[model samples]
Target: MSSDALAELSAQLPGDALLVGADAVEAYRRDRALDPTAGVPLAVALPRTTAEVQAVVRWAAAHGIPIVPRGAGTGLSGGASAVDGGIVLSTERMRDLRIDRTTRTATVQPGLLNAELKAAAAAEGLWYPPDPASYEICSIGGNIATNAGGLCCVKYGVTVDYVLGLEVVLADGRALRLGGPLIKDVAGLSLTKLFVGSEGTLGVITEITLRLLPAAPAPRIVAAWFASIEAAAAAIAEISTTIRPSLLEYMDRTCIDAVEDLLGRGLDRDAAALVLGGSDDLDPDGRDVAFMIDAFRRHGACEVAETGRAEGEALAAARRAAIPAVERRGRLLLSDVGVPLPRLGDLIAGVDAISRDREVTIAMLAHAGDGNTHPLVVFDPTDAVAAERAELAYGEIMSLAISLGGTISGEHGVGRMKRPWLREQIGDDALEIAERIKLALDPDGILNPGAIFEAR
Candidate 1:
């Protein structure tokens, strides 16, 4: 049956579109989260156009086979983990884009990388502000799938905010267009946003129309190093509540040391935590920078510095590289838990307690202004007991976030890794309504069967 289905799909797609065999399908199995339970797919379908995507969906629907929609496979939440006997639908080949200056929007195919989109917009003297840490490699389609937030999200907003429209291929091969460049369309049920963070459960995004802004001045940065984690956290809480920073981020001692070891950039390894704050406001008085410095001093920051353009950019880049640098220490169980700005300090303290209790190395970092943190739980894969403890700590961190009136996932979507805790975060009534919507759209549960919602 698998062989026959592969043949049918091959016949319908372009000659090089359908790939079978273990060697060809291996790379499509797992995303960045590297879910160990990810299954070997029956085939991978690389579609270059919307019609081809629709055709692949139709074929999978007819066979009642699951379809895992993947875009660049850079997702950190295992949202694109392949399923057994399913078809991996990759949109990496569908790279098309057009920037309309008049409309202040860019219409693009789902496969286009976020960096590529930004460059295109920059060439036209426009800017697309939603930039994830992996913006250089992560696809725009995946950003929409997770409603991804980033460094600039502290002020500029996330992926969903910039999305003006989308062309999605539904489970039954029907193409649906929602919203457009006009910006003020309230004629419908706001269905476009419904699919933004759906994690591919409802449909496959074929194309997107993103809102753009006129390019703004680069931000000036303030860097602070503290002798205590609580001090740094207190400063972040103060800055977040008091001012709107273009960027605000935090890194614990483990993260700072890891990054310093990797880059040799003279970072203070003895510091308990490092905080970076930025302001792009046109004010010449540099009020935000002064305010941040004062807050840091008041919170007992050991050392503080206001940097110029080159130095500031370098600092921001180091913050972005925190994840990969820390990963060099050991295998990681990444967590994306977030809370209200006022509770940021408590969340940090709770995570620290969990790490100590579990005896696991959790290198913490965050978009501090928005209270979204990425705690990299490091464990030696060779040590079974250590791995188990790390897993426990991972879930505990999410639970801690929930206890603080936060979410299990801030931007990475509820993917398989976080699915177990989704119910606890959202409650039964909300989950049921979400499940009903999933069934109403993809009755067979073919589109990303085990991503946001479980396969029935």
Candidate 2:
């Protein structure tokens, strides 16, 4: 990472495409994870097109500098954390999108924000379903990178479900278009699927072809409050067994108080847990809603009621705001661990026990119908002991999920922070195969080094 080399690399692209200077480079050091171990980079590259991205990759290949491809910096898994003396390739300037009404597909550059895509699709009476909590801020590229899942994913499916194609620039700077707008194409290996959640390890995705659905009916919502966490978990498990909810979310009391404190949203802070169920089926009998209400009461709900669209959307918005609200208390070690649907209660209960054992305040929330939960361990940064405990609690939650035959991450990719535990979950044989595949595609080991796997 010599200045001479950076100058040469900078000269390869347009003057405005490269970012240098201490402050500019520093700003790109961490994503939303705020990974403490993130390093300073040599320079940042803001490529506006696939050709510009190829120029950067070619220059990096010539110089052997690690390249960390970054989206909107909204990632939670430290997947975009900068590498020391490496190149930070920012796709923020690559925002180009086109919607094909006849094909019902969106061909977009990596930098388009998820909300922008949704709005663009909505204008044409279409819908793009994978709405992660950070959809408003997260880029479509980031969503594809992590295979991001959202509230309505229980019904519509995750990011991978919508990605129909991709144009990726490989490690050797060869741009390959993997798939197309065709609904079903098994012509070759599932290369498009490989890149969807690859987290920039295999290649840099410049464009995406996403499948879109016709607009759905406006959802009706239900809010259920429980006297005990167990009761809420029971209700979620029961409802999941019977009905496929458009949205099923869970928030523990700690999260409730945090959201209330932040937004003054009048959340029921006294309740042990709050569960929300949403449906868009347009069934005149409202069968799903009725079933959910019955399950809540049977599982000992303190109060259960169906609310109007306004209040329901507001509550859902609050659920989406949980992370930022809880962050106001202290720095958070966020854990996205999920278990089998039937073991959802066990996972939640285990997280609680870990928090108590480690003496940390753990605020919990989930896309409950899918059994994926975010258990946030909060601690003051200045308190070294507390931070250590928070880290321990975070690991414990992931390990507990593993013990229950679950994944360490349901949507957030296993970035550097979760890499150590990845082998434990996938086992040595599977990890070895993944490493072989990684080496096969990225023989130079330059693409997003030390991400899903260690730097070669």
Candidate 3:
């Protein structure tokens, strides 16, 4: 990354598009994961259009400079972490969008935030279902990159489900359009879905075509508190087995107490776990609500109640706040491991065991209906002993998920932090095939180097 090389690259874009110097490029070095090993980038390219992104890609390719594609820098995994001598190609400036009411789709640039896209869809009386906790801050591009799952995903599906099309800038600077707004297009390979969770290893997504639906019915919420974590897990399993809950979430005592400390919410800190279930079905009989309440009671819920719409939203918001609330306690090594529905209870118990054995505080929460749990390992970063224990517990949790026929990452992509575990979970054969595909697409390995796959 010579100054002369950077100068040549800078000449290809708008004067303001290329950011240089340590101060200018500092913030683009890492995403929310704060990966300690993140490198200092040669520059940050803020591309505003597909042509500009192509230019950046071409420049990086020509100079043999790695390009780390970043979107809003809100990823929990270090997928957006910068590489040494590489350029951080950020899509923050490409914030254009259009809604096709008749087609029920939104064609949007990758820079738009998830919440912003949701709001834009709502303005047209359409709804975008995937709602990750960080929707307000996480970019839609990042969500697609990770195939993000959220509260509504259990019912409506993840980001990939809504992504009907993508305009991607390949490693060689060739811009390719993969799909369109049409619902049923089976004319070619499912390339659009492939890139949905590629995490920028294959190409840089410049634009996305998102499918939208008419707004869901206002959901009825059921809140249940149990004296035992197993009991809550059992309730979740039973409810999931029987009903398709629009939202099903779990929070353990550690998380509950942390949130209470942060928001002063009257959460039952003494309870072992809290389970929330919601149903948006238009049935007047409220069958889903009844089933959830029954499951909770049958599983020994100490308290169960149906919250009003406002109260329900508040509870859901509290669940969304769990990550930041737990973060307030100490540094976090977040794990998004998930197990099959039947193995959900075992996964939760296994994580509890790991926390105790490792002597670390692991605050657990989940989109329980789908069995995707976020076991947040909290530790004092300055305390070397505690940090080591936290790291051990993090790996153990992912291993536990793998042993129980679960994925190392349910929604978050296998970013650098989880890259080591990916091979073990997916097996060498699958990994090799994936690497072959990566090589086929990104032969030079310049796009988001050292992300899903290691740098060559």
Residue-level lDDT of model 1, residues 13-73, one tens digit each, is: 8999999889999999999898999998889999998899988999989989899999888
Write candidate 2's Cα lDDT for 81-197 as tens digits: 999988999999889999999999999999999999999999999999999999999999999999999999999999999999999999889899988899999997898998988
RMSD of each: 0.8, 0.8, 0.8
Worst 10 residues of 3 by lDDT: 1-10
Global lDDT scores for all candidate models: 0.93, 0.93, 0.92
Q: Quote the positional error of residue 94 for candidate 1 in Å.
A: 1.1
Candidate 1 Cα errors over 4 Å, as ranges = none
- The deviation in Å at residue 61 for candidate 1 is 0.5
lDDT of 3 by residue, 152-189 (tens): 88899899989999999999999999989889999978
User: What global local distance difference test value does model 1 have?
Assistant: 0.93
TM-score attained by model 1: 0.99
